[model samples]
Target chain A: MEARTKAEVLRRLRSVAGHVEGIARMVEEDAYCIDIIRQIQAVQRALAKVNDLVLAQHLRACVTTAIRGEDPEERERVLEEIVEVFEAAQKI
Target chain B: MEARTKAEVLRRLRSVAGHVEGIARMVEEDAYCIDIIRQIQAVQRALAKVNDLVLAQHLRACVTTAIRGEDPEERERVLEEIVEVFEAAQKI
Candidate 1:
């Protein structure tokens, strides 16, 4: 991971963690149910963003290199991995 | 993605989605608060597992290939991406 990307992801995750804790507190305090669910959804979306950035970095660096390389095995492996990620994304 | 990995990830995600929905219902019924939080934590852990598998596939294919390739740029890029992932994992 690039240092910048690492820093960004960590920062976002930390914020998400705090958000989760806040939601938990809200629940404990008997806050509105729909509001709590909305917060959870927000955290999930934030996580999805982090996943997207990480996957993009993988594509730009690792996948591109494998596609450009001479070895058939490496190329096949990288392609399969990329397909897997896409499939997972569809599930999301 | 390899066919097997794709199938497994999809199946797991489907289950997790169901689990999440179940949690929502529990909340609606005003089920025990601690129990609901536990379920949420379980879903989060399940997601982390999916992320791990995707990351492992990246490492085995893209990162390994880049590290072995002749292009210094590719090598450096992959190494940095990996470091970033590790840093993010630590935040988790």
Candidate 2:
């Protein structure tokens, strides 16, 4: 719920987008192996922060609701989604 | 932000917590291999939904902020975090 925090996240994402594009360029230009790897690593770090922010929000909001709500279907769907993400995350 | 959506997320999380605890129990009891694996897989799925929800929020809020704000530190921190998460996810 930090409006400012949300804005900050977005700004960082845009910068990351540029770096990603740079990675594509490096590949096209046949950049050095380490350089490419370094860029990839940079992308990874950027994603981690985004991950933290999301997790924080979920704990604050989603987790709060699921406890009080009586609808099982909604709860199930959310549970299913979490599993999906965790699985996908494992792959990445 | 959908207030209702937040609530739903919480409910799902509680159920997942139960499942995770169950997995711990299975480990202690030396439950069937398949059963333990299945429970771990289930946990993975639950994490995924939370991931998506947070990502949506980031795109909506953080990305928007970085675009408008002049602060570079906030942006950098966010980017760094993303990369960290991405790497951790890879390990998982």
Candidate 3:
């Protein structure tokens, strides 16, 4: 990952971590069930955004390089890797 | 997504959902902090795996098609998208 991206991811992760900690406290205190679930949902969404960013980076750096490279075999390998990932995603 | 992968993903997601419910119960009962944290960690890891699988699918179905297609402009567009994703990731 680029330096800037790395910093941003870390920042977001830290924020998420803090949020999680607060949720834990809420749980301990017997906070409202709906409120806790709502917080969890927000965290999940934030994490999804992070995941999207990483995947995009992988495509640009790894997938793009394979496609642009001269070697046919490398291109094929990249293609297969992508297919594997798709298969995995489908499982999810 | 393939049928088999789709089934698997759904199964895992259901399992995770159940696990989350369990965690919520634990919170309600004032479970041990460490234990709750451990379960949360496991859930997070499971979630990460799901994200990876989705990303892989995107790369295979979307990125691969763009790379192999005849239109240079389409390829460029895909590349730009990948770059944008990377940029977005950095902001995470």
**How high is the CA lDDT of each candidate model?**
0.60, 0.67, 0.73
Tens digit of per-residue lDDT, candidate 2, span B22-71: 99999999999998998899888787666566655554356335523567
Ranking by TM-score: 3, 1, 2
Docking class of 1: incorrect
TM-score of every prediction relative to native: 0.50, 0.47, 0.51
Ranking by lDDT: 3, 2, 1
| Tens digit per residue, CA lDDT, model 1, B1-92 | 44465455556556665675565465456553334434555666666665665566667767787888999998998787667655555554
Worst 10 residues of 1 chain B by lDDT: B30-39
Query: Which residue window of length 10 is worst by lDDT in model 2 chain A?
Result: A59-68
Please give, for every candidate in the order listed, the TM-score of chain B alone compared with the true chain B: 0.87, 0.72, 0.74
Which residue pairs show backbone clashes in model 1? A1-B80, A1-B81, A1-B82, A1-B83, A1-B84, A80-B1, A83-B1, A84-B1
Which tens-of-lDDT digit does each residue in A1-92 have in candidate 1? 55565566556655665665565455456553334434555666666666666666667767788889999999998787667655654554
Quality of candidate 2 docking, DockQ: 0.11
- Sort candidate 3 into its docking category: incorrect
Task: Give the top-scoring candidate (TM-score).
Answer: 3
True contacts kept of each: 0.00, 0.21, 0.13
In terms of lDDT, model 1 sits at 0.60
